[model samples]
Target: MNDFDIKMIKKLILKGQWLLSEHALDKLLERNLRIVDVLTSILNGEILEDYPDDPRGHSCLILGKKDNKYIHTVCGFQNKSLVIITSYIPELPKWIDERTRGGKYHE
Candidate 1:
């Protein structure tokens, strides 16, 4: 495992060098989340966990705030671009809280 620089990630996001994964898009749509929300969450967010060797690619879980609520955004760096792998509200058995993991299903 390795760490991704939050500054670098922020830069990538700011430059529009980012895109959503198919699954991320679906989740965003299903949850009624907009791209702006993701961007805001990332730009103003912090890295909660890093998945430097994610099979999908090198990605990390970010915890960010959007309108006073917390949202999780998983971003991956691939081909010099940031790929939003997935995102969701931190809740239930999967998450103990906004910044803590609880269950076995993490990602």
Candidate 2:
């Protein structure tokens, strides 16, 4: 993501200007994740991937850690509102680390 996009996301986060989609909420519950986990992840996470051409507009994948677990959060923007598309913990054979994937990397 660009600096502008990151800035916008950070602003929304700081102002509590984001919301989770039903699907995202369901996933969170299924994974035993809490709202605070999402928020904390957003506040301190690192953007690992960017999707500027997403059909839903600009979005990015963030890598965060909570309770010693790596949480991957997919976030997008809708009408200037930060939308939580999905969130889950990274598993083996897919992720090498919280910030690095197992396959080839993309810039």
* lDDT by residue for model 1 (43-89), tens: 99998887766676677889999898899998876678888888899
Residue 107 alpha-carbon offset, candidate 2, angstroms: 11
Q: What is the lDDT of residue 37 in candidate 1?
A: 84
lDDT of 2 by residue, 5-60 (tens): 55677789898888899999999999899978887877778788888888877779
**Span of ten consecutive residues with least summed lDDT in model 1:** 50-59
Off by over 4 Å in 1: 1-3, 103-107
lDDT of each: 0.85, 0.79
Error of 1 at 39 (Å): 0.5
Top-lDDT candidate index: 1
Q: Model 2 scores what on Cα lDDT?
A: 0.79
Model 1 pairs in collision: none
